[model samples]
Target: MKKLFFLSVLLFGIFSFSQTLSSTLNKTTLALGEPAVLKINIENLQGKDVKSAPKNELLPFHLEETKDEIIKKQNNYTREIEFAVFEEGKFQIPALDFKIGENTYKTIPYEIEVINTAKKGDKISDIMNNKEVKLGLKDYWQLYKFYVLGAIALIALFIIIYYFIRYSKREKNTPKVISNKTLKDLELLKKKKYIENGNYRLFYVELLEITRNFISTQYRIPANVLLTDDLIDFMKQNNTISQENEKVVEDIFLRGDLVKFAKTFPDKETMGADFNDIKDFVKRSSKDIEFENIRSDV
Candidate 1:
């Protein structure tokens, strides 16, 4: 097992009959999270095997080992490493240590520049200087949308739930909306595949509407026009749902409102989970499934 060492800080390697190792970087400058390539090649391996590329993880940037290539005829070894820097600054991808069999090897350090700013220049500009840009509705909305939308959503939700509760108490004698119809609504929503298509806003809109409509018909509530808070209040007053189930239903509606008005994004899993939650709620909370079955039989 022979050892190799490089005292030279120069970027290039010295070639020899025994073994020559060299490293090079494909890029030195990149935007934050941009990736750079480091290539290492070894020649005259004399039949000993370096199974894989070695990487230094203690460095400032994230590093990953890419595919390695070995040529038996030429007795050469080559590997390309891909690394990305999230931090903005000049960085040195420190020399990586490699232990192949009993021989140890090191790759020379490489320089890199990671820029955080969106501009083409390297430096981050100073804090925003006040400039009189004409403010438009869009500008104002962008500045305060989270707060304003949140307030509106909260208010709308309250109105909806209040009406739902008021009417729900009056509909105790009303026939339960059939389970099949509610199930069809769920099926229709699934067929729309809004989440799959990345139309989250419309997806939530339809889902909330469906859930609310189901509640409106099932419990004699005007849920079609209500929000999460209204439904919560209605449930609490009516004792229509157990605390655990009420929590699930409330969370579903709240999440729907967030996606609809708060510009919240729900992932596929979240969307699917919420949909299933609504479906389960409708199945369990609907009051007259047995009567519906008997009526259908008749």
Candidate 2:
């Protein structure tokens, strides 16, 4: 009977020593937004691996896992888990369950206190026991009156000086003529060699854009955003473009639509002819515009 009692005690002591878990906090109290470490130490794991800790949402304290490790020493294993918290409260780090072999073990809960430093006017006095300073606008204005007045005077002086300089230079500068801009852009497009490079789609799109932009700028029409058919109808109704130039515009628009949407390829000679037609249309339209302006002036 004595031998039996000794055997049972030995087994109970070994079972108790096989699984051990303890948790501690690096600080019992901390200011809000400051981090404190909660260290969990586990020993004598008995050749069993520890399952991963539960997610942070399950814990009472808002905690995040930092560097944690399970190390083997001789016949026993030790595990150290670190957590950090930033919230302000008196909260408990709940018990953590770890799986070992077929059974589960848990660590003791730890508590921490977090103090908030920010407060409202009355609350600040209550928490910090300090008096508040009250200053009127007149007092503040007296301190920076010269700086404020100087800034306002400088801004007013800058505006007056800028207007004088701008008025003096306005008559010396000539505004950009839209026709000249269109011709320059067209010439640059030709140098890109889109036709010779067999980029028919790009060539047609850019060609259409140049013509539409020219018409839009010179006639105050929204030609750039219009479909080919709608643009032709608009120009016909307005009678803004001469009949001959109108036909040229219609033919170019049709060819561009075919090339862009239908993926039709045109020969280099055909593309060149289209280019020349656009140039002719621009030249005739510009002359007509100049004649109208002269007539209006007279």
Candidate 3:
């Protein structure tokens, strides 16, 4: 009875192996040089491990490459397989056989066909017997636009560079106005021997005009409208003159006031101090001032 039971168990295992471990390829036709994918699905396998195909009369095309994916479901395994074919001909993919425990199973042979490729344009040997033709204006303009755009970009680059250089040079060469020199030029006129000798009053008038001209250059305010009090107020408001310089400036205004209205005659030292004061005022104020919109009267 135990011998009979063992024989039944062996027969059942062999039947299970024969049902599983089967594979198949999908397509059988392909163009020459074109790729053909062969999918081999193995179902209800006991163990995954598949053996390499035998090198016999089968597989006239190159194997190229093979890829496999395994999936486990409940109590069985399935292997999804891919094989590539590269050569041209009718070919047979060889049978794949594998053993599960004491029993083995094998796949049937699959057939495939590879066709030739179609030619494009014309054969080069045939074209060697033909002649060339000339191209038209449409083709000429298409090529011309590329060169035209390149030339425009170059001209724009040169214009930008030239303008920047010219502007920089103009700024560097511009001259600043000297406010203190205008006042100093006035004082120097007063110090001349001619003022003390014959025209003392004329000296005072000239000194006044020099002070007004200094104000014009330094402040850009018209000098003709400014009186002694107006000059003092302007200097105070603008912070242009220092306390010491304002005092000297005021003294010159006071001296000019006496000469213009009261007709007073100051001694040479007194007169000379006022003259020096004008020189000092112009010297200090000129450095900080600019003459705007002034064309050279000279």
Per-residue lDDT over 1-298 for candidate 2, one digit per residue giving the tens place of the 0 to 100 score: 9999999999999977676766666787777656666555556766676664543433543655564666655445555555555776787776777676667877777777878766656442355657788889998999899999999999999999999899767634312366667778889989999877878888889999998988887776789899999999998997767789889999989989999986677999999999888987876776656655676699
Highest-scoring model, lDDT: 2
lDDT (Cα) of model 3 = 0.64
Evaluate residue 111 in candidate 1 and report its C-alpha lDDT on the 0 to 100 scale: 82
Query: TM-score of every model?
Result: 0.37, 0.40, 0.37
The deviation in Å at residue 47 for candidate 2 is 97
Task: Residues 1-298, candidate 1: write the lDDT tens digits.
Answer: 1222344422234443357678888899988877777777877777766644334443443543333333443477777666677777787777776555577888899888888757576686679877987999999999999999999999999999999998887565343434557779889989988878888888888887877777676666677665578778987786655566678878888887888786688899898888888777767764444444556699
**How many backbone overlaps does candidate 2 show?**
0
- lDDT of residue 219 for candidate 2: 72
Question: Which scores better on lDDT, 2 or 3?
Answer: 2
- Sorted on TM-score, highest at the top, how do the candidates line up? 2, 3, 1
Error of 2 at 52 (Å): 81
Which 10-residue window of candidate 2 scores lowest in summed lDDT? 170-179
Which window of ten consecutive residues has the lowest lDDT sum in model 3? 289-298
lDDT of 3 by residue, 177-276 (tens): 3453564576468557744685557777888787777666556555578778887888777665556767877788777888777578877777777777
Distance (Å) between predicted and true CA of 109, model 2? Answer: 78
- What order do you get sorting by lDDT, best first? 2, 1, 3
